[model samples]
Target: MAVELQKKGNFYMGEAPGMMEMGISNKNLDDDGRAKRTGTLITASAHIITAVIGSGVLSLAWAIAQLGWVAGPSVLIAFSGITYFTSTLLADCYRSPDPVTGKRNYTYMDVVRAHLGGIKIQLCGLAQYVNLVGITIGYTITASISMAAVKRSNCFHTHGHHTKCNVADYPFIIIFASIQIVLSQIPNFHKLSWLSILAAVMSFAYSSIGLGLSVAKVAEGSGDVRTSLTGVLVGVDVTGTEKVWKTFQAIGDIAFAYAYSTVLIEIQDTLKSSPPENKVMKKASFIGVSTTTLFYVLCGCVGYAAFGNNAPGNFLTGFGFYEPFWLIDFANVCIAIHLIGAYQVFCQPVYGFVEKWCNHRWPENGFISTEYAINIPAYGAYNINFFRVVWRTVYVIVTAVVAMIFPFFNDFLGLLGAASFWPLTVYFPIEMYIAQAKIPRFSFTWTWLKILSWACLVVSIVAAAGSVQGLATDVKAYKPFKTQGHE
Candidate 1:
């Protein structure tokens, strides 16, 4: 297998045709392939930053306000520790084989699905897809808010052209979909990587500028909202019951907001342009994941610090658009490009699964044959990578529509993702790895891993619970500004 998928004792469980071809599929993948795709230090570095940064980078101020400064970084550090241990364990399990067959390359569902089984797999798959789609929504929503904030910041609030117009939000969805559709058509990952790096760097610089300005203004007592800003910074000094209550709630909120580590899975395969079949256990497990840890810690802590209490609703857009609306729009347009790439890459698995089903139904249609049923106009039946084209379309449409209605709130999505990530990214991977290691471990090493896994399980519970609590409490509080003619 190229990435990770179902495998019987013999090894091959399934082939993710779409994802496998582009060399990013999680199934039908092996270590050697990953090792081959592994790029220079720069590419690897950018992958980590882009994967972890996402929507969370822009929403740091509001998140930190809920959690306070000291606790925010503390949670990030804790998440890194857990994420490393869990991600490594999962990667190692990927290396481990089926015990009965003694074969290695434990595919994604192949090894662990037995432990959890059919219903669980389907449920997890659904959850994973929702998380994926919802993530887009969260990002899109944050982007929309950032668009508004940036506009108002530059005094575009009164502009006639870019005025607060609410054409059906579906248009945003369709536009983003079109962007992804275009990108998915290109059968390359390297160019995309370069683009990702550019986006990551530009976003980092833009956010830093905004954060610096926000902090400076706050310090000078010219904060956007002086009283609210002070309240967030100093917090309540009152003691006794109220203080204890606030402290615990604050700590919980901080923890929930900061607890995100599984994003590694979401982006790593996208960045791995090499043949995943060749990579050894150590490189993929410890090396890749640990490297990822450093990036996340740096981006998260530095990002939160930079933005302070009034960071932009979208991290990349910063708190506001001090730049001209045209320039900002241009940036969003580029971002739309990036998002399309991401959406298609993400849509790979679902596309692959569908291909598998269709191939089975009509053996007459070869995996890559256009004889099946779908076609692209002028492009012809086989014009584009059929699977990739369809998948991107499906994802872009679904995600865009969802974003239009639901809006992607970064902190909220981050927290929810952390919660659901428990089983897939954390618990299952460690257990599967330990089981594969097979060394009887009452000893320190064995005991520690078991302990770590258990602790991660507990933390996942906490994160999920806290996330729900925060969402229930705060979700309804936000209201979109009225668009033109809506009032």
Candidate 2:
């Protein structure tokens, strides 16, 4: 008798007798001999939406208020166009040599390693993982703010609007962290489709709620709404320097909102290979980016029209919409739910990277490489790894603690967006595309791409500086772990 073997990661397992007769065959598997990926355009779009339409949307009104009527919409549109274009380029890089028929690149770092190896791989990993970590921390802070807002909203309704419904954010941060710790145990990106779908729905719910509330406020003509062609007035609304810094920060906010590119390759990897992953991913990117841009413009413009220069950093949680307390609470709850899924979508890659490294470095170690199957009621047998459990829990805790320390939502978002926008979103994609396409140096196409990359780099620098300045100013008044929310 002959033995049949199946490869699983770096190890091999003996095939059960008559497995082929039991309807398990290579025909049902992908080219890589793994389970065939069933993800389609819709799932990819859902993942993109879940990743893109996160806490960043809450800060748009404030961003638009800083830029005003003209530049606000214009900049938002510009980002949409740029992001969609660059995203198409990135989608093509999911395969090496020949995109349609070539071998697949499973991660963003893999894509980099294939096209532009050497130190570039390290640089790409650092930028990507660091941005992902920053985003998770931001999500933690934002989720806690929304949770606190829910409590504060009910308090305002029970009491009066003028009452100082001061709520400490620490408790909510712990609560959010606790939930993430549980959800983080769900393994990898392939298993998160259901969660992403639910989260995408939640994102739409909250974003629509914010947009509707803003439109209602505008129509009712209740607030002292103001409008300007050039945005906030220099002397009346802010100092000249303040205006400049805020304008740059506003750019960062918009840039951050459009930043799903960091995870493009990872998302693309989940798609079935039939129609070409690049083709499906490109279409998904268009749909996702377009949908989010529409929501962003409506929310940012209408919210600004309602609050003008006085727009809150977070319209829902910043007490911009105080009446209809239940609706406010519901919207905040939706935000919290959305962030929970968004956090996992961003953090899974980091988790995967570390776990892969550990497993490779200690292939023979049981602690790092072993998995135990545990049976649970209502849920079938599940594989558990002690190392994964420990590491992911610690990761969640660190992010929660950091969120408690610096909860300056707007400034922190601006900084993360600025620091990541150019390298991860703009620079790497262009460089990879150029290298893979073998475009002639100094040619028109190469020249324009280089120019665009450099221009975005400059934008990132200014935006980061402004965000740092804002953080410095905020830190002077903020005490770590003692921040209070007032409605």
Candidate 3:
């Protein structure tokens, strides 16, 4: 890769340090790595929780409810299975490079850069941006859904006002987004992890209430446990709609689970902090992926059960269900807060990129102060608001018209993400190991990664297909008054 280092340390896309080498390894890494800044495990766990529990999670019940009680459980098993394989393969890829560099370490960019070269290296960034930004958009929309749901029940009054929908909720979405954007630029954010914990706890409360209500409702009408057993014995599959993309949605869901590549670089950097041992890296992956899988399954089950019937939008209508508006109001507050944490982690790179650019591009004359500032300005950006207006306007035009011809948002989009990520996260790293092996054959692993890589490729394709299919078949929209589980 060609890097034109200007008088200042500024470099552009063409010559960014992201290019070259099998990975980005700074040999002079400190004894402590990137994670040295990390605090307690609760904080760490909180970070992971918020990052993974993105907007797609709102679809858990909405999607699972379509397949019935049985299908709800199926999603859990499927995601767990896919995540195990994907994570194991990814960990194995990292393990291959024995005596790996510390701190400044290899990244996803290097996997492609090593094998496919510069053009492909550039594409990796493109993939990262697409997956992450699309994810951001999806989060914003989900936040809107959550916000609108909360607002809805507050005004659910008067027989004549029943038809008056909450179209005015759009402004709230912009406001919620404004909150996220402002939080993104903050530094010294270890305390913000609590926001994720708050959301998770709120989600837990929501699931508990919904589950209790569904069970009580089922028991009251079914005439005892025997009837419940019988109901379980005769589960139905509503995913049998004529839509071809339903299968794709399932695939995409599976793919989305594997989108763990989003933080692969971070993981590697974390491992680099510890001793050069594969065990720690492998342990972290196993713990993270396994825990995440189980957590998803349990949460998905509770949500699906709460709905009992397949409906659309979110699994549970936060606002319209059960009693006081207090529950939903709290849920909205938690979602908004949790997303605040999520945006901060993801936006770091964007801010870092720009800062590095400005630092390097501008000459080290009397006009600059670069005392190793990490975080950019977090709040009070009048110019940014103006920029957002123009930006959103353009985004609407492009996304609605030109982007329509391309695959923008759908069930298959997740699958597309999974498919691209399969290579970036699972296969490529292991394949790189095989390519660079010192001894052509090493015990059983050399042969294993080879087989595993192909298997990973297969699963990615299948999961992506399933994600697309699931998305197409799973067409439940968020309505305030619908009962009978999500379908």
TM-scores of the candidates in the order shown: 0.67, 0.95, 0.67
Answer with 2 or 3, whichever has the higher lDDT: 2
What lDDT is reached at residue 406 by model 3? 26
Q: Count the backbone clashes (under 3 Å) in each candidate.
A: 40, 1, 44
The C-alpha stretches of model 1 lying farther than 4 A from their native spots are 1-45, 98-107, 110-127, 146-170, 186-195, 211-338, 365-388, 439-447, 469-487
Minimum summed lDDT over a 10-residue window in model 3 is located at 223-232
lDDT of 1 by residue, 1-487 (tens): 1122221121011232343444666654444433234444455445444444455544445444445556555655676566556655554443336432233332344445644456766765665555555555565554454444434434543555455444333445555556655665544333356665765565455445444545444454533442222214444433354333333333333333322233333333343433342233324344444553444345444444544454443544542434445555555544444444344334444444455455566544433333232356675443333554565567666766666655535435545555455666666666666566765769777788778767656665655554555455444663543321100
Write one digit per residue (lDDT tens) for candidate 2, span 1-487. Answer: 2222221253211111133343668777677655568899999999999999998899999999999899999999988998999999999898998999988888899999999999999999999999999999999989999998998889889998888887889999999999999999987788889999999999999999999999988889954777798888999989999999999989998999988887888889889988999999999999999999999999999999988888888899989989899999999999999999999999989888898777667766777666666777898766677778999999999999998888889898999999999998899899999999999999999999999999989989999999999989888877564444411
By lDDT, rank the candidates, best first.
2, 3, 1
Q: Candidate 2 versus the native: TM-score?
A: 0.95
The lowest-lDDT stretch of 10 consecutive residues in candidate 1 is 5-14
Which numbered prediction scores highest in TM-score against the true structure?
A: 2
- The superposed Cα distance between candidate 3 and the true structure at residue 64, in angstroms, equals 2.8
Cα error of candidate 2 at position 158, Å: 1.6
Q: What is the lDDT of every predicted structure here?
A: 0.47, 0.87, 0.47
Off by over 4 Å in 3: 1-36, 39-41, 66-75, 88-103, 110-119, 157-164, 187-244, 267-284, 306-313, 318-324, 354-421, 433-487
Instruction: Give residue 460's lDDT in candidate 1 (0 to 100).
Output: 57
